[model samples]
Target: MNFCKGKLRKLKQAFKIIYRQKSELAPTGLNDDLQADVMRRIRRLGPLKSGSNFLMLFEQFVWRLAPVAMTITLFFAIVLMNFDLIPDSEIFQLLYHESDDFSMIQFLRF
Candidate 1:
């Protein structure tokens, strides 16, 4: 029984030494440094663009090319509008196609 009490006392002392309370901890500068490092990383990486896939890249491309696409569409509409619809007296011109080559027509359509 005395040996058991001695072993129990030693185990209690070991537990006390191993599991000290937070208030018993000595101050170290590591916490401040870790906080500063975290803040710096956050500041450096402010806003992240999620363009990691084909659809995301295509969406970004569409947004960037919207103005150009609109301008080209407007230009084509204007050109087609400006072209005289009525057939002239002297010469006849095809509105859309002016080529015999099938590949050229396909390319133009594309």
Candidate 2:
């Protein structure tokens, strides 16, 4: 729509005005040294934390996390071992237990 196009054009013009660079020997205004100040502040901090630092942090915590993970896994294994995971109890009983009902066997045959 024309309205959207107008808004987009206005946004583009605003961005261009905000980010437009100028090469000059003299300072622009009183805040001319603001960029220098920001750079100095950033340089004061030695280095950014990289992925290797993150891995070392994770390695430090891994020993503490291992016991909890093992506990959960063992608990899950115990629960699964306690129950018959079959869908139908009737089929489970027929397969595992001896039954004396001739009618049920006939029905299964049918």
Candidate 3:
């Protein structure tokens, strides 16, 4: 534990030093104006393909959200099916009671 703490402190100090160096290296007012002038010389030739962009964005969104959706479904299914996991009390049972359309009966069929 002591070794871990010491190492963490050293890491924090190193990060502080690196952050100071990065801030020092950041462009000042005159340099930023000069860089903006340089960027103005670049030219845009063509527009992006909208169909491919929409497809790629939709796929990426699904890939990121699928796991979260599956996890939520699994959690609800487990909680709905396994009633005994809850304490044998009236209020708790009422709070977690399943709706008719999505009850434990429907879950057990699967």
Candidate 4:
């Protein structure tokens, strides 16, 4: 535990040093014509192909469908729990009923 704590302290000190030194870095200035040339080259390339477009559309569809999929999964989980679809176990019955007669062997035999 002491070793872990020492490592954590070292990590924190490293991060602090990095944060303190970050401001010393200089920013690169881009020329206005350079930006315009890059944009002109991009515009000349035209739109994406059908395959890339399909992938983008599919990505959007999956993003939109994620919540719906999760909702359906949760709904089914709740339904299964409510319906008691899981097999009854000796431990569960013992916990819920405080019964001593239930045996794991008998439960397994069925």
Top TM-score prediction, candidate number = 4
lDDT of each: 0.71, 0.74, 0.73, 0.79
Candidate 1 lDDT over 9-109, as tens digits, reads 99999888877865468675568779999989988877555434667889899999999999999999999999865544212233235535334345445
Among all candidates shown, the one with the greatest lDDT: 4
lDDT of 3 by residue, 13-89 (tens): 99999999998987655687677776665424234576579999999999999999999999999988986554436
Per model, state how many residue pairs clash: 0, 0, 0, 0
Model 4, span 41-107: residue lDDT tens = 9888877696589999999999999999999999999988788444457457664575467566755
TM-score of each: 0.31, 0.34, 0.32, 0.38
CA deviation > 4 Å runs, candidate 1: 1-52, 87-110
Q: lDDT by residue for model 2 over 3-88, one digit each (tens)?
A: 69889999999887766643354566657488788888888875778856988889979988999999999999999999766455
Judged by whole-model lDDT over C-alpha atoms, candidate 2 comes out at 0.74
Higher-ranked by lDDT: 1 or 3: 3
Question: Model 3, residue 92: what's the lDDT?
Answer: 40
* Best-to-worst lDDT order: 4, 2, 3, 1
Ranking by TM-score: 4, 2, 3, 1
Clashes of 4: 0
Residue pairs in clash, model 2? none
